[model samples]
Target: MIFPCILSGGIGSRLWPLSRKDRPKQFLPLFGGESLFQKTAKRVNHSGFSAPIVIGSNDHRFLIGEQLSELGITANSILLEPMGRNTAPPALMAALIAEESDPDALVLLLPSDHLIRKEEVFLEAVRGAEQAARDGAIVTFGIKPSEPNTGYGYIKVVPGEEPVRRVDTFVEKPDLARAESFLKDGGYFWNAGIFLYSAKTMIEAFKTHQPALYEGLLAVMETRHSDLDFTRLDADLFGKLENISIDYAVMEKAENVACAPVAPEWDDLGSWSAIWTVLDKDEDGNSSLGDSRFLGSRNCLAYADQGLVSVIGLEDVMVIATSDSVLVAHKDKAQDVKHVVDQLKSEGRDEVDRHPRAYKPWGY
Candidate 1:
């Protein structure tokens, strides 16, 4: 069986105002009233996959439960992390939990905040990589690059006729010139961070490549306790584990790493501009979420949480207005929104943390 493990521990500060510490972008109802998390859960809700295992922040336990309850989909286990420890630990933790039931069970590790337009294509790619995964290869789904996007990391794969190809190397985010060069080279793909591997395969990878972290996670799991519907790991033990990504901890070191190149119209939606691209735009290239209008505006996005928002004679500009905060920036400069978030964080502003109307289990 394929056990889908959803990783939902990111702050998503790049999409601030709409996305905050209390409620990140994944939980926000951005896509026609459904959150990215909900979409991710629904994507794997197939007969071929088992009940999902969610690993998210402890602070978002209630939010997670409420969202899952809304969908009427029960998770196999909801593991709560006291604090962020990146992807390496959760990947291994999910493997460990799945290994308890069946050592050879395949685990599909996914990020909750990704936007995949073509779900069927993505699933078909997963199915294609299943055999490679069962054959002891840690198969990562590499999105075929439509553009030379410098926002995401790149994976270099040996081109072949097989469904899964041997990964040559992983490359960090590159500059525009390097990104263009990668596009020119047909062997490069965007590293989407989606992995398919057997539970035992991942556990052994961790044991071999990251023995210290492996031992530490074992200790943390030993003292895990259940809280309501969530499984809580030992805070102290978890906090002490190394803050590293699975790419660094295992994939880069392992010789069995493979890539399944696919084009599913995938985007991480890391910034407001990215959000604008996926949204439905008008003839004038203007997109609005709530009560908003545009006058002679082209390639602009406006999101109004409560009141009316209007943009006049603007080009490539975005306006995000919430009850408490308003942000206006050029579409090209959307990636710099994180710097604004950083400034707010430095001032200890409440806007950086959450909106005025907070979401709770019982009531908002």
Candidate 2:
């Protein structure tokens, strides 16, 4: 059976007003009615997948359970991290847990913050991954590069079968020149951070590629506490882990790595600018998330909640207002607006990391 493994602990700092530390992007309903986590769950559900196992922060256990209950969806488990140790450990931990019950179960590892508009294409890619995964391959969904995105890493695929191929290399975020050249060339796809593999294969890859993480995960599994839909891992041991990603820990070093193409209109929704791309534009080519009044404005995104955002003749600008902050940046520059929050924190600003209303398992 296809069991989904949702990694919900990614704290996106770029989408500041909407995505705060206490109420991060995954939990925020910035997309529409459903939060990104809920939307990811729905994707797995609509694909006729089995009940999922979610891995998130202990602080978000209540919020997660409440959300699942609200949607009338039940998860197999909800594993908690004491602190954010990045993707490698949590992914390995989830794989171990899944192996305990079903050694051969294919676990589709998904990050909670991505937006895939073409669900059918995504499912087809998953189906393709299923074939490669059964052949002892750790498969990743690689989105065809539409433009030169410096924000995302690149995955070079070695030619193989019709649907899936061997991953030749995993490249870091390139410079402007290299990114442009990558787009000019073919065979390179954006690393989507989505994976599919058997519970058994992932655990073994961890043991070989990341022995330290493998041992750490073993300790967590040994003493993990399961209550309702939550599993609180040993906080101290989990905290000691070296902050690393699955790419560095295994995928880069592993031989049986495969890349499956996804033809979906997908976005990680990592920043406000990315969000603007998916939203409906106004008559002036502007996208407004919340209530706002605009006059003589053209090609601007206004997400106003705190006060009246009146834009006059602004071209390609992004304006976001929250209870404690207002961010107005050029549309292209919104990607770098996160540095503003970083500077705020350096001056002892708490609003950078938190919002007025926080979400919990008991409800928002």
Count of backbone collisions within predicted model 1: 0
Per-residue C-alpha lDDT of model 2 across residues 139-245, encoded as one tens digit per residue? 99999988898889999887655698888899999988998998887788999999999888998898888888888778767888777667777777777788998
lDDT of 1 by residue, 18-48 (tens): 8999999998887977889989999999998
Which stretches in model 2 have alpha-carbon errors above 4 Å? Answer: 46-48, 358-364
lDDT of 1 at 147: 86
Scanning candidate 1 in windows of ten residues, the lowest lDDT window is 355-364
Instruction: Count residue pairs with overlapping backbones in model 2.
Output: 3
Could you tell me the C-alpha RMSD of candidate 1 in Å? Answer: 1.3
